[model samples]
Target: MNTRDLLNRRAPVRRAPASNPAMFLFGALLCAAAVAVTYWAFVRTTTGQLADESAWREAEGAMPGTKLPVLQFLDSLPLLSLFIAGAVVLAVTIKRRRLAPAVIALGTFAAANVSSQLLKRFFFDRPDRGVVTLDFNSLPSGHTTLAASAAAVVFLLASPRWRPAVAAVGGSYAVLAGAATFINLWHRPADVVASFLVVGTWTLIGGLIMLRVTPDWNYWPPGGRGRGTAPVFAAMCWIPGLLALVISVGCYLYATKSMTALGSSEAMLLYFWSGLGLIIGVGYVLSALACWLFSIQAGDQDR
Candidate 1:
């Protein structure tokens, strides 16, 4: 070939997207740390122990007939219903004909629940500790685990374009279900928080797997397809989380001081509600973060 022909014979090169696998790995590690810290606080720390028992005692009062029926109904939702719904969502929303995302998404639910149960049964024990709380371990509530895990599955199954809305709505559902448990005295605040962390951990791991197995379809475009309200959803998470943190800290301090001075007073009741709000806020925050994390661009295809 002549020199002119040689200069024109350049080969096209395909470059990878800006997304880094290390980011997902870091997210997974961060989630794991959250779970570990939450578990340790509940099981080992004096303040954590006192706070949990106080919240439980404050929440364990008699409930009205109206609220009892509602909470009981929420608690009685069948596991099969979640599986069926998850299957349907997976069938409908998945644009690409890939099995890895679906299988890993569903597996996340199982992993989270099984891990929670195993931890509750064998790993952690709630000591008597001279308190009136139950001796049995209930750090990660089984009911909350079911709710949060189900939400994670739905979030995973949703299309990348719809994930923000799914994260907001589904996170709200999980939060409400967890709140119902606290309102009905089914679990303490720490129990629900631990359940959230467990679900977050498994969901992050599942998200990393999805990124690896289906990088092409698992990301947002450069201009972002101009779809989804992830930023709005993230704002929803941050606003409530900040407010709840302030309220919960105040209530926690009050409860700690009042146990000796006022005993089981209105302060304890305030503490219970505030702690419950904190759990819900944290749940939403984690869900929103996961939604954003999973939306990272997978490859240069969309760009």
Candidate 2:
């Protein structure tokens, strides 16, 4: 080869994007801890059981007019639906030449749903908390798992710049599904929270593997400058996420400290909204965290 040609070919190699191993590892552990705490607090303790039961009963009061449509949406998503969604996502990823991230995201989805079922059926059980509930345990809702894991998969496989918008829209759908289950009395508040934590845990684990194998494309625009989606969607997620959490806390504390006599309808409504708040808060907060983490870890893609 000519000397000029050789020199032209000797350009500097760009570094791959950075990954957040610590965030992925400890974030998963934190999710697991949250799941355990949710189960124990809402399933094992008498007060927790009472509160959970109250919320469930209040949800039962929801008219069929309100609950029927939600049931329809939930029923439309059978096991086969998951497979179809998975296949479509896989095909899209492979088309874009992102085989590794696709596999990890899909695996995360499957693992989360399976774990939730196993925990409900074989492992975790409600031990006679004496709150007048049903005989079988149903902690960690199946419906919520299906919905949330589906959302998480899309979020994981998306480009970092698009994650915030995806998170807002997709996370809202998951929360809506979770809330639907709660409203229809299919599951308690604790059950939905457990599913959220389960999805979060699996997502972080998948993210750990995804970062190791595919770091080059896991990046976003650093500032709100040029050709990026405005942080509008991120604000959409953050505002509701923080508001729901604070209001949920207030609902719980108010219920605890209320001068009203026990079991008043008003107090029951408080507990109900509190449970719903947990659903919305945990779901959106996870989305917001994803937005922030990818922005921080992936660095400026434009550079």
Candidate 3:
């Protein structure tokens, strides 16, 4: 075989996109920060000296609806769905001879689960007053962390053209799980926030590590097609944006109804809306940024 034939054969072997060392470093720092924050928060909550145990207790008391059926149903769905989806994604990717995403996805799940448990065990000694029955650690909600990590992994494997849509769906599911935990009084608001931080930090770290280690892996983004910015590309991007908007709005509305039903005062309602707005705004902006970055990177590769 001549040099030209060898070169032609090698051309089809896609180079893995360069992993940003900075991103990996940042991810490590963030993961450590999450651990520290979780530990501190857990200690505070458990010690009963942290900020307003009374407030947490009051919030727990304000939980609406009977816990017998609805809470059980919602709680079961998120974790189960997360596991099932992750398993399916893993299976399909492996069958297609794409191993990196599957491995990374599993690793991400494991990391999130471990971190969440550690936080829970460290922070919470017992359930709050409103919690009639107890099962797991309560500091950083396990369900929320699982949902967030699973959704993030799924988004990473999706086609750039389809990422927004998948992310929107996945994000909505995650939010729903968080809401269920909150409304059920299973965890405080801070616990949900910590869970997100932990999951996101680890997923970013795991993804960066996988990309760095397997520079030729084409498992993610499947088909190995370079990014593009063709006119049709705008439509593909918009689809996810639109989906995200819908989901965000839906979640906000649901949260509003739940809060109102629980008879939250006007001041508390305002705070809720403000917090919800911030989360949705940040999510949309980040989604847009991810799409833009993907387009630029893909376009350059295509060129």
Candidate 4:
């Protein structure tokens, strides 16, 4: 065989993930659990509300003089950004001749966004839990949903070789966008978390379907970048994410020293970082989860 034929012969294909349905089911169920827990913690408990609202109030100009660059980043990724990225997703999928993936991506995108609005408007209710907060439901942030769903589209269409990096960076952007929404007082911490879970559910579903319909392009080749790259990319996301989680917990712990201090500026700022950290850390974790799941499902393709 010539050099080209020799390389093709040696090109390792990953195991088809579609053979096992359990991974997708578990991921979807996990997303549902996360959303339920977030809602219960923030809307059903006084402490949760106090913590959520403290962070919300902080963003209502607690740090009057300081400005964050993240806000600018958020502004940059407006609805127009979604349109552009979505177009790119479509273009790439079409170019690769992956019609099933394209359709699935678009379907999930629409389903996820509609689900968020429907859940917020008609389904979910914020009861008067004696927290003195808004009664209207805002559990799942619309901005976050929009951003994450867009990222999900890209994730679904990406091949295994690139999905790890895409998952980490895209998830970070979407999650950080949620932080901007709450920091600007558009939503609460729970709202952002809820949005992430919502998008995650749909993404998982899409992944499962795509695996069944289009496993041809879902595989990673062996001996190219080596097998270590995927985990490395995932680590790039979750490492900082876990550290932020730790910091957020520490901030919350210190802020809760006294009852009266809960509403103080210090407490409010502390809560601000806490909420930011939660969103960031969760975003990273989810991204890493995607990396891990896809890696396993799309192992060296079946011969």
* TM-score, every prediction: 0.84, 0.88, 0.62, 0.88
- lDDT at position 292, candidate 3: 44
TM-score of 4: 0.88
Q: Residue 217's C-alpha lDDT in candidate 3?
A: 40
- Candidate 2 has its poorest 10 consecutive residues by lDDT at 221-230
Listed per model in order, the count of residue pairs whose N, CA or C atoms clash below 3 Å is 0, 0, 2, 8
- On TM-score, the stronger of 1 and 4 is 4
User: Which one wins on lDDT?
Assistant: 4
State in Å the error of residue 260, model 4.
Answer: 4.1
Which residue pairs clash within candidate 1? none
Better of 1 and 3 by TM-score: 1
lDDT of 2 by residue, 1-303 (tens): 999999887554444566769988898999999999999999989888878887777676645588778778778755644864587587768788767777788888889999999999998989896668887889899989998898888878877767777778878988988898898888998999999899989988987787777776575544423224526676788889999999888887888787433356553588887888988998888877766665556645433
Q: Which stretches of candidate 4 lie over 4 Å from their true place?
A: 1-19, 62-78, 222-226, 260-262, 265-268, 301-303
Global fold similarity of model 1 (TM-score): 0.84
Q: Native-vs-model 1 lDDT?
A: 0.72
Runs of candidate 3 with Cα error greater than 4 angstroms are 1-18, 31-70, 123-137, 216-303
State how far residue 274 of model 4 sits from its true place (Å): 1.4
lDDT of 3 by residue, 1-303 (tens): 998898767333333464565855665576568556654654344432122132244444344455555488565876686776677676659776777767776787788888788767774554453323343446677777777777767766665556546655665666666656655666654566567677666756765665566544422343434333322444443454456456545644564555533234333443333333323333333334444433333311221
Write candidate 1's Cα lDDT for 1-303 as tens digits: 999998988654334545566876787778778777887887666667767766666665534454667566565744643864577556755656777767888889899999999989998876655555576778798888888888888777766677777788778878887887777777878889888888888887877776667666554545556344667776777777667777887777766665532236544476676667678678877876876776654333233
Error of 3 at 44 (Å): 3.6
Record all residue pairs in model 4 with backbone atoms less than 3 Å apart, i.e. clashing.
Answer: 13-300, 13-301, 14-299, 14-300, 14-301, 15-300, 15-301, 139-191
